[model samples]
Target: MIGGVTAVAANGPAVNVSSVNVTPTDPTVGETVTVEVTISNQEGSNSIVDVSSIMLRTTSEHYERVEDVGAIAPGGSLTIPITTSFDSAGEKNLLAHVSAASQSNGSRTSHLRAYYRPITIDVEAPEIDAGIAASTNNSGETTVTLTNYGNVELTDAEIRTAVDGTQRDQRSTFDITPNESESVTFDTTNYDSDAVTLTGAYTARGERHEVTRTVDLNRQVQGEIRLTSVEVTERGTAISVDGEAANIGGTDVDSVLVRIPDSETVSPASGAGEFFVGSVDASEFATFELSSSVSNGTDTLPIELTYLVDNERITTTQTIDLSTASPVSPESSQDRPAATAGGDGSAGSSGLPLIPLIVGLLVVVGGSGLLYRLWNRE
Candidate 1:
C-alpha cells in the first residue's frame, strides 16, 4: 500500500501512470541519467484530464518536478522526462507520480494522482592502477618510466631520484593515458653511489597514489695504461724510443704523457725528451716517441708516464733494455773514388790501369834508344 496508487475520486477521469524508461541502462557513479515517465487516460474515461505536475524521487533523496503539463483526452497518453545524477555506487530505488484534475458534474476536481512501480538503477565505482620502473646507463644517466595500466588516465605525474645522499626531482608536468607510458631522465655524474632509489606520484580519479623503486647503477672499475711494442734506436749520441700507449681498462683517460726523466745513465735529448699524448679512450691506443742521450756502457733505459684519470693524477715507470736497440747507419755516396789499392798494383787515387801505362812507357824508351844509336852510326 505504501507504493500503490490511490485515487481520491473514483468517478473522476481515469488518468494512470503507464511506464518508466531510464537512459544509459547501466550507469557509473557521478554520471547523469534521464528518466522518462509515460501517463495515459483510460479509454472509458468520461472527461478530459488536465495534468498539472509530474514528480520523481529516489531513495537517496534526489527529487525533480515538472509543472504545467497541459491536458490529455480520452484514449490518449503523454510522456515527461526528468534528469538527475548519483553520488554513490549501488542499486537505487526510484518512484514517480502524476498530479491531475478534471471537470465532473460542472465542478472542478483536483489532487487526483497515480504512482508507477519502483525503478532500480545500478552504478559502478571508478578503478585505478599504475606502475614505475628505472634504469641507469654507463654515462651515469638515470631514466625513469611510468606506466598507467588501468582504465583511468594519470595526471600531474612526478618523479624523484636519490643517490649518495643527494636527491633530484623532475621539473615538468606530464600525463599518461590508460595503457600508456612516459619517461624522464636525470644526470648522476657527480654522485658516487652504486645504486639509486626512485619515487613517483600521480593523480587518478581525483585520488593521489605513490610508488617506489630501486635500481643498481652502472659502475666502471678503475683501469690502467700500458706500454706495448716498445722499440729503441741509437742515432749517434741520441737515443729514441717508440711505442704504443694503450688503455687496457674500462674507462677513458686524459692528458697522457711519456717522457725520459733525468738519470745518470740516460738524459733527455735536447728539445725532444718528453712525448705528449692528449687523450686515449677505453680499449684504444696512441703512438709516442721519447728522445734521450744514453751514456756509454749503459744497457738499460728508464721510461716514465704521467696521465689523468677521473680528474686524478697518475704516474708509472718502466725500464727497457738498451742492448737490444739497433744503431742507425747513414747511406754511402756513389760519386767518390775508393781510397785503397786495386788489383795489378794500380793507384786507386788516379783511377787508371797500371799494366797498360807501363807497357806504353817501355815502348817509347826502346824506340828513342834505337833512333839515337842509328844517328851516331850515320
Candidate 2:
C-alpha cells in the first residue's frame, strides 16, 4: 500500500471482452446465424496485446471456427463476425475465445477472454406439387390439382390455367396442410388439342413457391348443314319443292334424305314425302326435290332433312311457304310444267294459264245473248 491507500484491482480484463452479439437468435434448420465478438484493451499502461487466434465453438451438431487474428493495440478494440448454420433443432451454446499475450504489472503473461451466448432453432420446410388431371378435354370442364408435399403448412394456395399457351382462368384455396391436395376446375371449351398449363402458387414459412404442369387438350368434331334458296312449284294438283343443301361444318355428311313432311293440308303425291339426294361432302352443295299434293292458299310445308355423321342419324327440319306458286292444269294446257322423272314421275310449272280461261268466258256470254234475242223475237 502506497501513501496509506489500499491497492484496488483492475475491474475488467486488460484485454476486455466488450460484447458478444448473436444475430437471428431464433433460427430455423438450414438457415444462417451471425455471431459478433468485440474485444478491447482498455488499459494503456499494458503493452499491446498480441491476439494469436479467435475461435467460435458451438455445442450444436455442427462446428465452425475463425483463426489467425494477429493482434490488437492497447486501448483499441477488435470485432469479429462469424456466420454458420444449424442442421438440427433445439437449444445451442456458442463460445467466442480469444488467446492473447499482454504485460500485466510489468510481467508478460498469456490471457484468455471468452464470451457465451445461446441460440434456439426451429425447423420447418414446405414443398409443393401441381399437375393437370388426366383426360382433360374441350367439353368446357378441366381439372387441376395442387398438393402440399412438405412437413409444414402452406396458405393462400392458388391455381391458374393457360389454354394453348394463353392465360384463361384461375381458382384458389385458403390453406393446405402437409401431404394434402386440392383441386380446381376451369372452362376449356375455347381451347383445342394444343396445350393446357396448370400453375400452383402458395406461401410457407414466410417464403413463396410455385409449381407448373402441362397437358394436351382433346376436342370433338362438330358438323353443320344448311339448306338455302327454297322454291315451290305446282302442276295440276301436284306440288314440288326445290332447294340447295350444303354441308358447312368440319365433318362430312352421308346418305342425305330430303322430304316434305305430311301435314293436314298436304300429302305426298308419290309413295312417301321423302326423296333421297345421296351424300354431301364438307363445304359442298346438292340440289333436292320433294313432290306432294298440297291444297291451295298459304300452306306451311315442313321440309325435313336427315343425314349420317359418324354413324349417327341427324335430322333437321325447315319450314317454307307455297303461297307464291301457281298450280297448272293438265287439260288447260299452257306451256307444260317441267317433269322430274323420279321413281314416280311428277311435274313442276310456273305462270298462270289466264288467257284461255278468259277467252272461253267471253264466248259463253256472247252465245247466251244471241239465244236470248231470238227467243224474245218469237
Candidate 3:
C-alpha cells in the first residue's frame, strides 16, 4: 500500500524463518544438546541486511551461540547453529528471533526481524552417578570412570574441588555425550578423604557453564592384594616368589604401580641409582623395580618378590606378603643387649664388658701356688 502503482518500499528486508528445529529437546540435565535456526530469503528481495540481531528467551535452559553465515544478498539464505544445555529435566519455552537491519542511501535507516513462533522444547539434562571401586588403592594413584544414560551430552566435564571438595586443583576433566561414558584421575596425594564429589554438564556453544554431580566414589575396602597362597620355599641362591593381586572390588583396576615394603639395606643401595619407575601409563597397573636381594651381605643376593599392586600412590597400602629366600644366616637371634645400662644388674647394657675381672683373673693365675714356688726356685 505504498502509492498504488508508484509502489514505495518498507523499512528493512522482508525475511522469514524457513525452519526452526531444536535437537534433543528431551535432553538430560547437566548435558548439552543442539538447536538449529535456519532462515531464508522468503521474499526473494534485496532488502536483507546482516543477521545483526538474534534473540532467545527461556526459563530453565541456556545455550551457546555459533554464528557463521557471513553475509546474505537478495534471495540468499543463512543458517545459524546454537547449543543449549538444561540444568534439570522439565518443559521450556523459547522466544527466539532474528532481525535484519540495513541503511539505505541519503539518510535512511531500516530494520527487519524474522520471528519463529514461540517454540517449546523439552529439556532433559545429564545425570552421572560416579563412584570409586575401592575406598583406597594401595598404589597411591587411581582412576575414576563415569557412565551416562541420561538424555543430554555431558560437556565441560571436570572436578569441582580438591581435598574434601575445597578448591579445584590438579584434577581432570572430560565430556560424555548422551548415553556416552568417560573417566578421570583421582590423585590420592592432595586429597585423602573419601568425601568427594564430581561436577560436569552438557555444553553447546554460547556461554561457560557450571555443573555438579554426586557420584558413588566409594573406596573399595577390599580390592586389596591378599596373599591367599604364597609358596615361600627356595629358588636356588635366589628366591622366586609368585602370587596374584586380586580385585576384590566391583570395578576394574585400570592403572597402578605395585610396590613392596622394603628394608633399605635388604637390597644393596642400588648402584644402578634410583630405579626409574618408567612412566606408569595405565591408571591402575604398573611394574616398578623388582626386589634385587634378600639382605645386602655382599652382592645383590637375588630374592624373587612381587610388590602389592601400587596405583602410583593413590590406593590404600596394598597389604603385601613378602618371602625372601631364607637368608644365608638367619637374622642374628642374640639380643646384643640394650642401649642403656646402670649399676643395677638388670639394667640395659650399652657399654663394653667389665675389664677389672679380666685383669684380676690373670693376676690370680700368676699368683697360683705352683707358679710361685717355681719362680722362687729358679
Candidate 1 TM-score versus the reference: 0.39
The true-versus-predicted C-alpha distance at residue 85 of model 3, in Å, is: 4.7
Residues 1-378 of candidate 2 have per-residue lDDT tens digits of 001111112442466556667665455566667777676777563476656566666555335667766566777888888787777665565456566666566554555444333433333332344333534533447767777766556688898877667788789976887667788777777665558777788887677878787876554444556787777887856777778888876567899888877777778767657878788887788887778886766467778889887678899998877676666666655566654433334432433345565799999999999999999999
Ranking by TM-score: 1, 2, 3
Tens digit of per-residue lDDT, candidate 1, span 1-378: 123453334555677777778876765576567988787888988888888887777555647889888788889999988887788988777777577887566455655655455677776665677788877665667778888887566899988877755675564447987679889888877766767777778997678897777777665644467888999998866788999999987788899988889988788987789988989998899999889997888888888889888778999988888887888864446656655446655456677666687899999999999999999999
Question: Candidate 3 residues 135-204, lDDT tens each?
Answer: 3354344465555554444466654444555754444457666566666665554465655555543343
Per-candidate RMSD, Å: 14.1, 17.4, 21.4
Best by lDDT: 1
Model 2 TM-score, all chains together:
0.38
- Give the alpha-carbon lDDT of every model: 0.77, 0.67, 0.48
TM-scores for every candidate against the unseen true structure: 0.39, 0.38, 0.31
Model 1 residue 281 lDDT? Answer: 93
* Runs with alpha carbons beyond 4 Å of true place in candidate 3: 1-12, 21-24, 30-34, 58-71, 82-88, 102-108, 111-114, 130-147, 151-175, 181-378
